[model samples]
Target chain A: MSTTARTVVELIVNNHPGVMSHVTGLFSRRAFNLEGILCGEIGNGTQSKVYLLVNNDDRLEQIVCQLEKLYDVKEVSVRDDYDNTIFTRLHDLVTNAQ
Target chain B: MKLSGAEIIINLLERQGIDTIAGIPGGSNLPLYNALFKSKIIRHILVRQEQAGGFLAQGMARSTGKTAVCFATSGPGAVNLITAIADARLDSVPIVAITGQVAHSLIGTDAFQEVDTYGMTVPITKCNFLVRSAAELLTVIPEAFRIAASGRPGPVLIDVPKDVQLQQIEFNTWPQPGKKEGLAYFDNDALLRAAAMINEAKRPVIYAGGGAMYSGISKEVIKLAEKNGIPATLTLMGLGLMPHDHPLYLGMLGMHGARYTNNIVHESDLLIALGVRFDDRATGKLAEFCPSAKVIHIDIDKSEIGKLRRPEVGITGDLAAVLPVLVDLVGADKREEWVKRVETEKQKYPWSSQNADDGMHPLEIIKEIAAASNDDAIVTTDVGQHQMWVAQGYPVKSPRTLLSSGGLGTMGFGLPAALGAALANPKKQVICFTGDGSILMNIQELATLDEHKLNVKIILFNNGYLGLVRQQQELFFEKNYIASHFKSNPNFTAIAEGFGIEAYQVDSIGDLKTTLPLVMAKDGPALINIYVDHTHNVLPMVPPGAANLQMIGG
Candidate 1:
């Protein structure tokens, strides 16, 4: 098993049609890959919380900074304590299924 | 009123005042194309490739500062559009790309021409959508335009399934266009602090970027610089924010920037960076960049404030809104000694190309083009030595006149983008300055140019090599030239002639001077192949990982 240090970037964004695209596009254009993602409406449904699991790299800081620049992205936080085992479990299930 | 998804999309596009769109049709998007055929208001331009379609939209958007549109089919078509979408994202060009997708029922079943476009485009677009039903089209279409055009403009994608386009939906009224809200918060304290720094600083340099161009605050920026007597430098994307020959304007900074400009930035006590992210290329080595300066970073995007270099005072607001306030707060105080010192250095270390009396120099040709066009022509360039030469030699008089892929450094951007610019502004002359290697990447667009008869003058600097890459090899790898040189080159003139455009070939300096005017004077599309020396290099180049001050050559 490859044990790489990973972090979950939680974002509070406007729950709109293209908001997810803006957030994910920032990472993609920078060539940063996402390991896992979970998003759902939060509060009164005007905003949503997006959790992005990504490999902790040198460029991660820059990516985090860029995410905060988006107009629709209300808040961004890098959570080191978030559980990454969900991604590993999903990966294992997918590999074992075939 | 009841309308199909295709009708809603066409109606929305027409409502948005979008008259021109560049794209290629395919199987999945046939319904949308069918709807497009029924509408006479919006004209769809057929491009040779999907990438050209995206770049064509970029050219129009960057030229007009308005949201531009492009369309592509599912899978391969969408994949091809990714490069341009990435380009638009990095450079902050407003483009909305509508792509076809496999029907919802077939999605994730690995159906023919099925790719998860929504998943793939997440990282490249400002925003993207996967519409499951036709009813979603009403809101999605207008939202795509709004998001793409507002607050740090970028590309947005709408991935519609075939079934969704064919589905019918009844609507009482079309969704009204969303009004772009002003920035919710402005730090008055940060503005005052920045003003204080500017007032106290002995040597201040105003560094501008694409944000200044986007905000249309060139006049305010120039006023701020002149009012306080600060020398201004621009990033590659920030070119044309100030007139090329403006008294206080220092040419482009970082990498292939002027040596004196880089030195001036290094020597400054305070750096007023506006609408400019300190990109890696613009700041060679981050630690060493502007080492002596205390930065006052101002941008609409708050995240860009301390992303690379932590600023002493960071003000987040629109350049258009923030600059006028800063101008009023900052008292006019001339730094005579500092200005004189910078002027002395500028004269001391002049940027000059290698003089070759026998053949046409690339810089000379650029100057001739600038002269013939009166520095008012909208110029677009592909990434290479010729791009650097154009940045150095050509004098841009206004913003949106010079468009190039700065952040992504995408090649083959010139021709397609020039096509967009020409189509957007029918009255203005659009010129494409490209290298032999770069031009070949999207040379098929010459057919589009020939068909439209766009007044785009293409000047190809044929050096028979990937000149910039070769220069890097020569300097860094002990001249071990690998795949950089092209041994057998095609006749570009014949290629242009095959496309039914008037073509000229210039091998000498006199020929270039005489041929350029003749080509410029000609009404329709024309191509001029100017053979340049293969060994010529864009000098004052900062090597990879080197500091901005550690530039080599020239």
Candidate 2:
């Protein structure tokens, strides 16, 4: 497969009721179907990290920016390059699911 | 101990800056209605049906850009309003729908008028909540508003059980929303590459979509089109992106779109798809769509790109951000040959139609409506032949000026949508063009319009039949009318009158000429029923599953 250049969006959000709904709502409204989303708790259960991998770097940034403006969002970062580490983690998940 | 749930609802709505609510009272919501009578804080608009309430609320939301609220009882009442909410959601109109559920004790027992209202609404709404307790109603009220207005703007549902509506919850100032987490960082490098593709391509076309209108980037879209010497085509939802009269404007594209527009898109070297999803209607047999084009798809949604068709370059950023850069990067060279080629094609395959005007032509009616309304007036339409006629005949110059259920052509969409538009912008005139069949779906909304005193001009095209279905019969079904004709068509003017709305009937051209000006000048909701030929059809139609060149007429 041709290694397509992609972008990654990392979201840090408050662990609260309706936060996931709101976050998912943004993606649904934007029509951005997440290719890969990995979510887990990061700090003392108050916040968590959400990883979204999109093929287009420009799109990744845009999603990050919009996510940043949400009330429950603590921080957003866009990795323009498809980091091998994230892919490895995703690959592991697929392997685990299988 | 038993302060009614409806009372709490009234108190909560008053706190959320809602002075009025449009809805129908049903068995499940009767308690709420009883409580509403006791509260001096809010005005209740008792519409005839739940659907009208939904549309009225949508109208209010569109006018104010605030969350318009509606109420209904369980089951069919809630379900009846579903189409309107879907309409609002698809058009990005902000609305908050609150439904009354059965008492907690009867929950899941399949009690009278019980249905999974929340489950039914999930796909259409931005978010939904079923308040398990009255303590949550206060929170749900403000949260519903916040969610409906926060990002791209859409409908939200809060289904409150009867028992919860009676429970007491302490009211406080709405909490300041927590911080948003992430940064959307656009890759300047990707934009540069997309810009390079645009600059290098000789046949560049900007296919603007509903996203452009929603993002408020119409001006930017026009600037980019003008700057790059690019001919532009708008999706049905993107009708007003470039002024209809602009030299580069190629009109709407897709199945029913202009032949030249689709042909150019097919042959173009660079396709800049902005704020538009590659819907099947727009793409028309996607395997062969834009076969030669290197697409630069600019959308806020990450999933849209490559979902239907892969783009050469995809920028998932706001049209606000990407459009400016695209406009700035374009060179000073005008594609004169390209412009002439498009114009020649447009003339060759123009969006024209002709009908023997035995009495009234739908196109002429739409044209007159467009001409009479000022630039400030907003026009909305329901689906069918009337919608296509409006699209072809109406010359929209401003973005968001025309609101229609393009993605979901829900019949009976126009009246309520126009009500929402008129309510959204109270100062601006709003008109809804609804066909006879489409209007009957939610015709009771005429009473909703009457009760609210909303200044909406409704142009009801009474053809005594489903014109689109009739057209299909003519072309494919051997002209056998079948179930298409409503031989027992009700007198719409009398129906409007019964609803306490001013009504005018026009059967002749002279009657239309005399009545249109008078109705346009009047205040409050007025219905003008123009008797059109049942046999008259919208022409220049691409027969189903046919190429653009195989249009019925032009």
Candidate 3:
């Protein structure tokens, strides 16, 4: 019921230049919350797995639908049950690094 | 066969049946131009400015409902193309733009005339690509076309580095030419519920947008409006959906809409929104627009359904596939009382242009053009007061006949777009309505028109000022009138003649009777410069951040 509820959107996309921009630009352009992102190429370096920490707001469905429309974005899934600390622990890691 | 990247790009475009491409050549794109020189199947038009080339492609795309292509070099050329590409994106015109980027190895080094085109185009394009190798063109080129027109049409850009254009690859088999992706599957229960929503309403209104035209479903939507005795009001992009004289037609509804049309929409109990996004320009102060209405929205794009306004029943699919099903499912009714009320509202406040005394008023000029040209004639307009006047007064007989920059409201669109239309539909005349301010934005396109020798008649309204900005200043900013007035404007008739096209200078509406027929009947391009008074404002305007009901002038 909270507006600040956290979730992760996992994306399977083509591994190449400009794919990251296409994925991140969606959040910036639409003003959707993207608190954190984790990505890398997978399986023979032809595909990538991207995890975006975002707000679980009313716009999440529309956000997922828009992401699915991207040509390089092969698959999109919203993981409400995934451990969001994968992103939250980053704050502690950065503080300790300093 | 071994083919260079530039040759492969040209081959892919030719294989897609692209006959004409508008572009400008520079250092980065020299290789691509060299390949274009040998293509017997494709012809290129050299535009003076890079931005107009993008719009030239939009004209062909918007008028024909197909994906059109344009070309440009990197950096400045690609930057100049941003406005037109953004315009196409907002208006949903399908165009594939191929720009020549710097060498792939020198990408981050900031080499001469190099810019991150893929980065710049991300926000404005449906999707964009930075081609890394020559082999990638085999799939990327076709995919560009597919992604452009797949569902909701939009612009697509592919930035190819200079090195790639020279790189060669060998292949035995060619890939299939790209076509639009298949239509989405329909939900039967949504259609049934939408029909019930229409059947239950006592006072229903149909609000259609450019999607109706994009889907080529004008006849079905018009049938629904006529059969159910419901009034239909169109957005600026949707003007040609219904004939102007149709009894069920309620002109345009928005900021400058006829008082009655806006009032009727405000009072309606049901709004059947079709292929429309409910843009801010159409729904002034969205919180209060159609406050009493329950909406049933259908569009091809899924995100647009509830993006701005929530609908009682939302269906995400093409109107071509959706409208006919709803037509059969809903029971027809006269609803004479509601129709009578709408007619009375239309008569009482009425479109201000309806009572014109046949003078040199902009509305009269539009009517004169309508009278002189045949039904097949196409019209394109630039942004500002004249654009709104034409949208408010012109009698567009069919969809795609009226080409306008509705979503982005880009000035300088009329000239090049009209040129593209003239090139595409050579048999039909193209009438371009442009104001002095808008004309000067891309006035160099007159030379492109002269080179083609097509039938395009440019009607210029020389008001000696940015009329719309002046009007807004007068209303909203207490008539400060800063930077709105032009102390000196060019003699456009002389300018047109300098471009080697026929030109005429007229003073009054009576003068149009003589010059319009001569220009409209001529075989080649012409320009008619008519004198108009400045400070003339488009009326029935809703003040900034105000509701549709709170209007200041008519």
Q: Give the per-residue lDDT of model 2 (tens digit) for B186-261.
A: 6678899998888899899889888788777889988888888988898888888888899888888776676677
Point out the higher-scoring one by lDDT: 1 or 3. 3
Better of 1 and 3 by TM-score: 3
Q: For residues B101-174, write the lDDT of model 3, one tens digit per residue.
A: 99888888999999888899998999898898999999999999988998899999999999999999999888
Each prediction's RMSD to truth: 4.1, 6.3, 1.9
The estimated TM-scores of all candidates read 0.91, 0.81, 0.97
> Scored by CA lDDT, what does every candidate get?
0.89, 0.77, 0.90
Regions of candidate 1 where Cα sits further than 4 Å from its true position: A1-98, B353-359
Error of 2 at B17 (Å): 4.4
Task: Please give me the DockQ of candidate 3 compared with the native complex.
Answer: 0.82
Q: Report lDDT (Cα) of residue B439, candidate 1.
A: 90
Write one digit per residue (lDDT tens) for candidate 1, span A17-87. Answer: 76876776666666888878888899999999998998887767777878876757889899888776766
Query: Which order, best to worst by lDDT?
Result: 3, 1, 2
